[model samples]
Target: MKDYMGYSIEGRTTAISTILNQYSSGITLMKQDSNGEFYPLKAKTTILPNGSKSYILTPCNQ
Candidate 1:
């Protein structure tokens, strides 16, 4: 596991639900690859079928 800005992250892929459950909304999420490079996930706020809120992360065009 690695710590980034006080957030404990484990594994290469993490579920968006896990992040939203932990940090709530309006928080930017960053992903670190095996090479130790940080990348921003283009987070889009979404509402689930149950009406819960979460974020969907996609690769940034840049």
Candidate 2:
């Protein structure tokens, strides 16, 4: 596992429902598509500094 901004990265795949249940509050969930675009999954979200509720998904090609 790795650490990212105080959050632990398990580096494993899991169901989306499991993630939503774990972070049931104050969190915005997004999923990536085959076209490299991201869409919101959950309604509960946090407003970013730019006043946007969602962000662009940047994929790591490593």
Candidate 3:
């Protein structure tokens, strides 16, 4: 699956379409802190299954 920044998560990937099926709204923007913890930037964020935290991306205007 790919995020807004065009980063791809390969190998046994869960389709973003499938996720959207469950959450027709949108994907959550997450960030990892220096201590290695994931947190959402918005309150209305989607909680991904499997609790995977590998796909977090830095927010960008482009």
Best by TM-score: 1
The digit string of per-residue lDDT tens for model 3 on 1-62 reads: 45532445521123443454346567754556788877643222345687744433223321
TM-score of model 1 (CA atoms) = 0.32
Q: Could you give the candidate ranking by lDDT, starting with the highest?
A: 1, 3, 2
In candidate 1, how many Å is residue 2 off?
Answer: 25
**Candidate 2 all-Cα RMSD:** 13.8
Candidate 2, superposed: residue stretches over 4 Å from native: 1-24, 43-62
Residue 15 deviation, candidate 2, in Å?
9.7
Better of 1 and 3 by TM-score: 1
lDDT of 1 by residue, 1-62 (tens): 11321243422233553464457677656777888888766545678899976554465546
| Clash count in backbone of candidate 3 | 0
By lDDT, the better pick of 1 and 2 is 1
State residue 51's C-alpha deviation in candidate 2, in Å: 38
- Candidate 3 lDDT score at position 28: 53
